[model samples]
Target: MALHLYALAILMGAIMSIYIPMISQSARVMGAAVMGNVPFFFVAFVTSVVIALVSGQRGDSFRKIADVPPWLFLAGVMSAGIILGATFLVPRIGTGALFVLLVTGQILAGLAINQFGLLGVPAQPMTLSIAAGAVLVIAGAALVTFGAVT
Candidate 1:
């Protein structure tokens, strides 16, 4: 089941990778980027509220969120920062390069999360494949940056 789930995730990611820039940059053009992800998370949260209002999805599924201390609101602020960074980055670097950096960050972050097992996330046992993939992503980002410069 895990293998199949991973496969599906990879497939969907591959599909999205082809189109994410178009969507993000379009939003950026409309000044969504400058809003610091107010639109991004607002759209997501509003959709969830709409879905709940329509489908009557009950609470307790997000019981864990309520468990969080109030001070953690900073995460929401940081998410906006990240969204602005990505939104602006899309126009400056193009999607391919922007995503390469995103991938690089994700890889490093995943490693850190695995190392510390933070946020109730299970620690993943890393193999050589993970390291190789990180190295490849870094190389890819470097290539894109160099190509764009030259």
Candidate 2:
């Protein structure tokens, strides 16, 4: 199960690497970042409905949806913001810089989430090694984002 999870993570990474560029290009072609999200979410909503129906857990999923707090729905808002921001920034920053910066921000947020057990995540107290690793990641992001152009 753990190996499968790792593989899924890698797969997600690959998909996202392509997904951002596609979003970027679509936004450029459409001449509006916000416009890109219309079809994007339309497909996302349809795909989610299909998955729910096919998974045989639609009832359970709907039941659990009611259990979630209203504030948690802000995640959808945040998702829209993230997608919009990515669409706008990718063309300006280029994919490499955008990805590195995004990963850097995610790592920092992950650290906080782990430390505090935020959003029901398991608490994992920060250690020196973890902090050092975060530092190294930030440095790498800096190099990738601001390094001299060839």
Candidate 3:
């Protein structure tokens, strides 16, 4: 079970590596598409609105303020944090470093997940080995990014 949990965490790290670069590439393409320095961020906002409107519909849907769930409002607030973080961080560090930071952040988040035993995920007690491993992994990332012997 411990090995399985570790594998999932590594897989998530790999996924973050791939997905973040892909998104940056897509954003660059979108930037190239507009030619007028049009903010690529509008793409996300536009899609978000369309998704909420379309997916919110049920077989016999009725859109009403009173029917709106508080959870949806909370989600919107969270989304704001996500978008703001992306805009600020992505431009500064570039996607590679940003995803590296994200993976490290995920290590902290995963520990919290383990501590609380959230979402039926198995709890793995944190240890020095895990902390040392995280430091080593982050160091390896730095070496790969900045090049060794530089």
Best by lDDT: 2
List model 3 lDDT by residue over 114-143, tens digit each.
Answer: 877875799887788987887887786676
Clashing pairs in 1: none
lDDT by residue for model 1 (1-150), tens: 599999998998686575456557667667665654555576879988888767866666556578889878888887667666777777777777777777788888988898678777888877798889888878988897677674
RMSD of each: 3.4, 1.9, 6.5
lDDT of each: 0.74, 0.89, 0.63
- Model 2, residue 106: displacement in angstroms? 0.9
Off by over 4 Å in 3: 1-76, 141-150
Q: Which stretches of candidate 2 lie over 4 Å from their true place?
A: none
Worst-scoring 10-residue span by lDDT in model 3: 32-41
lDDT of 1: 0.74
Which candidate do you rate higher for lDDT, 1 or 3?
A: 1
The estimated TM-scores of all candidates read: 0.71, 0.90, 0.47
- Cα lDDT of model 2 by residue, 38-149, tens digit: 7888889999989988888667777888898999899899989989998988878888898889889999999999999998899999999999999999999999998966
